[model samples]
Target: MERKVPTGIYGLDELIGGGFRNNSVNMIFGGTGVGKTTFSMQFINYGLNRGEKGIYISMEMTEEQIIRESKQIGWGEIEKHIEKGRLRIIHTHGEDIVILSRFLQDIEEEIGEEEVRLAIDPLTPIIYNVQQKRHRKTISEFFNGLRRFGTSVVTLEEMEGVEMMPLYLADSVIKLQSLGYGERYDRTLRIVKYRGGKHGEGLYPFSIERGLGIVVDVTEEQINRVTPKMKYREYFEDAKRKIRQVEGELREALLNKIEALETSWTRDESPERVLQMFFRTELGREI
Candidate 1:
């Protein structure tokens, strides 16, 4: 129960109890404008400032683009880490996996290398890399390789379905959400899931301020919070059970409506009659 990786995002740190457990892959999922990339960068930049070696492999933007933004985000010192061999920013196309695998191999060979932080910004492009042929085995191998690298890691994942793959592999998961539907937008973030650590399910509001960095305000009121090291299986099972009951009730109601509509005894379908028919047919009540 050693608390490590401590994200340093005040409220988030308290909720997740330190930070993401060491040597794990974490999915940070959200829509395009939700600032998933920025959050990932912030996490990586924080690690870099601590002199922890890190590799930020990005498919969406080049190394220079992220570095430039890092400077604008008040992390210009990250460039010094890159020069000191404590950080590496790589941009890859279809062959990113191969390149990253080789890089990991090199780090393995290096004698006396410090613990690394690996951030693969927006893991969505990997789908296109293998042309959707990537299976569970390949994905598990991907995560396994990361853990083998022996570092604290967070992988940004752009997902289609809310149920995504890397979440199953990662020791933690943070989901970034946004305000505004269209052009005008503001960013919000939440920890959607985590394994082997405590994390809150409630949405914690965050903002990227020019002077303050990624500040998380816990609100003046006490918000609902989950236990650190909460039982993952139990929570998920309870959630599934609730959803199943809801679905069954919805289906039953639909069937009853169809049956009532088909009955010749039906007239205007009044509120009272509908209630009466529902009780009589479903609950065995009198006409």
Candidate 2:
């Protein structure tokens, strides 16, 4: 079998069975601040590092803005790659078919020389120009043109669970979400589907740090860190098991509190504190 294209995002490659298939289009859907842009940039940079040319087509951000954001996230060498002609970043402000066609033309021409890693950030704007029925046909043809050169990744905005037009067209789909549970937000990444590849299912908690970018934890222990329900349930189970050792009305009261544990409490307060509070109050001692 041919080798797959590495995304360069740690832990993600393993989920999709050793990265993406070459000459394939992968769809990445995420809401605001869910690290879609950063991930795409990282993918391009990774390809560049491996001595492969890359092209980043943006419908929203300028070249200067992309360079600035990439630098902030420790991907400062983007400019250097561009300088060496190993990378190309294009911001297509065009909204119509003709303009989009021209943008595709540039990409086709660039990829003619060598195998390149391509990223189309927020592919929504380009495809949204046409009607819904025409969207599938138009977008499909556009992506088909891209595949003749190299593998590509297209980022899209999640439309509140609505069926996106691009999701059906891409070879692989990666969905990202940021849920505000507890005192702060928890980010998650899930592989929706990877055609002809074995992928891990379910939401895996991920963090977007400054230098690290996006890192996902597939292990049970690491997953428990950001999984509120799982983490709290473990805490509840431990307390429940221990509470059984105590006798009489005190134990009964603790049981009631455990059953009464609300989602808000699990999120706002620490689960360990719930048991500690009961111990301190009933036992007349701090734990």
Please name the candidate that would achieve the greatest TM-score relative to the true structure. Answer: 2
- For candidate 2, write residues 19-138 as lDDT tens digits: 899989999998987889988998999989889999998888999999999889888888999999999998875374455556678777776768899999988776566545566787
lDDT of 1 by residue, 10-93 (tens): 567766656777777777777766666667777777777776777777777887898788888778887798889887887876
- Tell me the whole-model lDDT of each prediction, alpha carbons only: 0.62, 0.78
Q: After superposition, how far is residue 134 of candidate 1 from its true place, in Å?
A: 6.4
Model 2: residue 3 alpha-carbon error in angstroms: 1.7
Worst 10 residues of 2 by lDDT: 222-231
Q: How many times do residue backbones clash in model 2?
A: 0
Query: Which residue window of length 10 is worst by lDDT in model 1?
Result: 261-270
Clashes of each: 2, 0
